[model samples]
Target chain A: MALRRQVCFALYAASRATTALYRPLLDELGLTYPQYLVLLVLWERDGRTVKELGEELRLDSGTLSPLLKRMEAAGLVERQRTAGDERVVEVRLTAAGTELQARARSVPAALVAATGLDRKTLVELRDTLTTFASTMDIAAQELAAKKK
Target chain B: MALRRQVCFALYAASRATTALYRPLLDELGLTYPQYLVLLVLWERDGRTVKELGEELRLDSGTLSPLLKRMEAAGLVERQRTAGDERVVEVRLTAAGTELQARARSVPAALVAATGLDRKTLVELRDTLTTFASTMDIAAQELAAKKK
Candidate 1:
């Protein structure tokens, strides 16, 4: 099969392309794509533990730790160990991060406009891909279990 | 729209999920996902210039240079300035790279099995994403032009 025709390659390319489109927009907010995703989760619900954020983002601590560190250093977020549960590190958007949400509201609309795809089509495509990812996650678990 | 329901986030999550699925299969080949993508292009057609590879892969020189360097160091591929055009650097697979193709063919199959999606569905999804990406590219170009 041609690399271009491969489903995995198509997802890989489309993901990067979409991220590239967001680059200039997100740069104005001083955020990278993944960092922007982190903020997206936090914006939806604040003060999530690292485990909660990782589950929502499907990212492990290895990847999330340094990224959270960078976001904290940028003063966009604060990470605190919970007093009741010392092992749990909760991430909360700082004032700057919360304020940035107002500006970020325009991002999804701009990205939708950039796709030039109708709302129905965009939603359908997203739903399909989301379902596919969920199926793959289940399959991956099976594969890992077999290995064990 | 909720962040979880956003089309871009769905694509981002799906892309990473699929890559994570490929991780173990690719690890056996000593290849990262991007590096495996580079080899996919090279395996299809040998001796492509960096520009050509970048165009096919939609990667900038900065990202491609280091990746090509790593591939070269691993002895999977070689990069050299063309004798006819000193400005052009061509990437060609070494013997090991060519031989690795036999082992690499299993990767796609393994990934397909892991996804648990039938071939037809996978192909259709891939085509949809490819077309979506192309449309987004044009829209991005228009957006840039309007800004100017």
Candidate 2:
């Protein structure tokens, strides 16, 4: 198990490196990586429940709650309890948050360029990682259940 | 720019998922994911400088210092300032730390099995990610310079 060549290390390194690359690009737009992700979900479909946001992002309430609070403070999103269900809090984009999308359009192309791999290879890698994540999630669930 | 299809998102998800998979495994050894990474580096080569560990792990001193302190508290590592250069702190594994290697041996195989990938595909993906990380690092440096 060479540390340099380990798959887990590769994933950690690549993900951090990608985040580092995005730092400057996103900084111009006043967005942290996780915040950008939250925005991405809302950009695709506005007014998702905080529960739905957490499920989509694989984040827990503790983490997503504070993040959403920060986003609300920044005027990017506004959270409200649905009248029909007080337990259901929905996250909807603000005018500024929705308009930030126009400025954020350049972000993805910037990351693709930094990858240094052609479109097809990058797409393949993304799809493979996505599949690997699903498998790992299942494994984690099994491991957690076995522990119980 | 579909959020689900973004390479950045895939990388983030895969990395976090892998870390989750490693959580229970590492917890059994009383180690966190970053702590496990430190042990992996130390297992390969003992007594690396704090700066060296930071570079190897791509962590800033602010992050690494507390981690090393925690490891020291756990009797897994000891840090000493070099006699010749008091500025440099060396991290050496303790007897307990050195012995933890044998226990950690099964950890890598467990992760690989959870991955559900054949050897060849995993190797290729690791190599690709390694290269991608390097390219992204260079891009980050250039962006930093441009910002200056």
Candidate 3:
């Protein structure tokens, strides 16, 4: 079978394409896709620890540390070492970060508009993606277990 | 709606997860995910131009330039400006690159063995992803047309 035509290939392709779709819009806002993802999580609930954010984003500290530092420098978020747990750093949105949320609220709508996919189709796609993701997660965990 | 649980989010999650699945295996061969993807494309067919690679990989010059440069630096691929089109760069595998193919051939089987999803589940997931990707592509084109 042609790898290009494989379902896994399509998923990978579409994911990249979708992220690219956000590029122009996000560039205007001075954000990368991962940064936007972090912002989204923060906007939804403020003051999440580094570990919590990493778990939510499925990113490791190696990637997240510099990213959060950059975000902190940009004045979008504040990172403070927790008093209770000195080892833990908490990330909370700054005023600018919170304000950015209002601007970002329109992004998803713009993306849907940009994609031109109907609402129903988008929902269906998301459902299938969730199913695939969950299955893959289970598969990865099982693989990891066998290795140990 | 929970933006975190949306199809776009799930798609992004799955894309990252897929790469993570490949991380340890690809690391053994000293390749990053994007680098591995480039090799995957080239393994299927020998010489391809940068533009062709970008199209197949769904990456633009901004992302591919540095990536290809890194690959070229690694001695896995050689980049030469095509005689016919000075603007075009063609990537051809080096001796090391060709040799790496033998090492990479086992990757698919390893991934399949590592991922515990049954064949039936994989097939179903693949079909759903294919449909979702095709529909998304159609929508993207339509949106582009409307803007033009």
Candidate 4:
């Protein structure tokens, strides 16, 4: 239990630190961390269905739907339904969204400067976390399968 | 950028996983994760000031104040103003709160069983995460100190 607490605490602290680093940067661009996450997903692949974004981000519709609506209001992204799949909502980046990328390009450097973690530590932490996520993802899936 | 995403993903994922792991167990005790966190702090040392609890949990007064209010309402804890300092609100567990430990004792085992993560992986992951958090905490303090 103590060990689990330690790991959970690290993850919690790291998330807060990362958000703090991004807070100032994203504020300049008028974005929150979760909003920025949505933009990142769209940046990687434009015009993805809302369900896809939910799955990729591991968020449920309850969280994403409202978030997407807010993003739409901010004009960073647009949501539209395809003629064939009226039930599905597809999200696409606006011209402003694409242009915002150039401004956000410096975010990486700013985060590095703010975090003050050495590259070695960052890489190692990332690798370990990635592995942990993969393991958890598999575990969650297996557990679901077993329930079914 | 990929590295930052990895770190953020890990943090977000781990937070969700930890909450999920605790949810069912906590439900049996009628506690939420944050509420459980509050209980844990009081378990270790009753009569901590709200400010102290906020610091220990890395939460802000805005968040902890309301949470403590709810916990007080739940009859798990009581908030008293310190005689030495009128500004301080001391949080002490109630008889009900202290007795809850017996019920919560088995929660950690249930969480481990649900997650299905091997003990070895859990330990290593915990160690790595703690190292990461300690390093980042130092860096954050140094950064905040510089700002001051």
Off by over 4 Å in 3: A118-120, A138-148, B113-148
Encode model 3's per-residue lDDT on B1-148: one tens digit a residue.
Answer: 3556566788898887777777778888999978888888887898999899887877789999999899889999999999998998999999998899888777776665555567776677677666656666666667567779
- Please identify model 2 stretches exceeding 4 Å from their true place: none
Residue A135 CA displacement from its true place in model 1, Å = 1.8
Give per-residue CA lDDT, model 4, range A1-106, as digits (tens). Answer: 3323645565666667667656666888999988888887778778989899887787889999999999899899999999997999999999999898889888
Which docking category, incorrect, acceptable, medium or high, applies to candidate 1?
medium
- Clashing pairs for predicted structure model 3, backbone only: A126-B7
Ranking, lDDT, top scorer first = 2, 1, 3, 4
Q: Could you tell which candidate, 1 or 4, scores higher by TM-score?
A: 1
Best by TM-score: 2
Residue runs of model 4 more than 4 Å from their true location after superposition: A1-5, A137-148, B1-5, B113-124, B134-148
lDDT of 4 at B43: 88
- Candidate 2 vs candidate 4: the lDDT winner is 2
- Interface RMSD in Å per candidate, to 1 decimal? 1.3, 0.9, 3.0, 3.2
lDDT of 4 by residue, B20-100 (tens): 656656877889988888887788878899888887877889989888888889999999999998998899999999999
Off by over 4 Å in 1: none
Model 2 lDDT at residue B17: 96
Better of 2 and 4 by TM-score: 2
Structural similarity to truth (TM-score) of each candidate:
0.95, 0.98, 0.81, 0.87
- Rank the candidate models, highest DockQ first: 2, 1, 4, 3
lDDT of 3 at A74: 92
- What's the alpha carbon RMSD for model 2? 0.9
User: Mind listing the fnat for each candidate?
Assistant: 0.75, 0.84, 0.46, 0.37
Query: Ten residues in a row with the worst lDDT in model 1 chain B?
Result: B135-144
Question: What Cα-based lDDT does every candidate model obtain?
Answer: 0.90, 0.93, 0.80, 0.76
